[model samples]
Target: MTVETIGWNTAQRRGFGELIARSWSDAGLRLRYEREPAEVLAEYDIHLAAGTTAPALPPSPGELVVETFNAAEAVPPPPCMLSICFCLQPDVKR
Candidate 1:
């Protein structure tokens, strides 16, 4: 329920991929990837949509956007590039 901006890195990207896989599996939701994590990070922009099921794509700003259902009842799968973004940010204790 909290939102923050994050930058990209390899460790973070890999972690995020693992998180996405885990989240989807835990929620019993299946994810179909257009590209593998490494390939996507190396080549495409991440798109995040707050209110739609349809995956957003290029021409958007930032490295990539993590998409999720806008509905409160829906459990969002982890962002595809979350780990990458996390890596870009400084480690801060919260």
Candidate 2:
């Protein structure tokens, strides 16, 4: 898996959310959030899998796990912004 960090911004956040929704719809998977975005600098974790077509919701069990293992060495986002982790699958040859 590959990890990427997106800077917090109004436009970026909207675009990112839309992209995630589309991806989940196309993949027949549900998007699960770890928590609600109710803070000024809220952080959310979106977990996706390769099965089921139920409505998007929070993780239940045996779902994807997203973590910031190297958060100490990472740069924090600007204040009054949101941050999310996007885990992408590795490219493979047929």
Candidate 3:
């Protein structure tokens, strides 16, 4: 699992997830959002524990989280962010 973690740093962008999303997108990686990494990894983006779950699914065994106090939740939201996990499904393998 090529997991990447960006720790908390004032210089770092707020909202771990929001930054991750933008980074992934910039890398040309298609992603979706969910609350469970295990389940969402198979379909959408990474799962956020403190995040909301639409169609809930059991979280994965090992989870990676990037915590930050400067989250983009401040008014006027700083571009937003979220964690994303993904698994290459059979269809995608082809």
lDDT of each: 0.36, 0.35, 0.35
**TM-score of structure candidate 3:** 0.17
Name the best candidate (by lDDT). Answer: 1
lDDT of 3 by residue, 22-82 (tens): 3343333223333333453333333434453333222432434434433356676444243
What lDDT tens digits, residue by residue, belong to model 1 across residues 1-94?
2112344455544544544443343332222244333333332233334442323221223344434444466477445544433222224321
Model 1 weakest 10-residue run by lDDT = 52-61
Count of backbone collisions in candidate 2 = 0
Candidate that beats the other on lDDT, 1 or 2, i.e. the better one = 1
What TM-score does each of the candidates earn?
0.24, 0.24, 0.17
Relative to the true structure, candidate 1 reaches a TM of 0.24
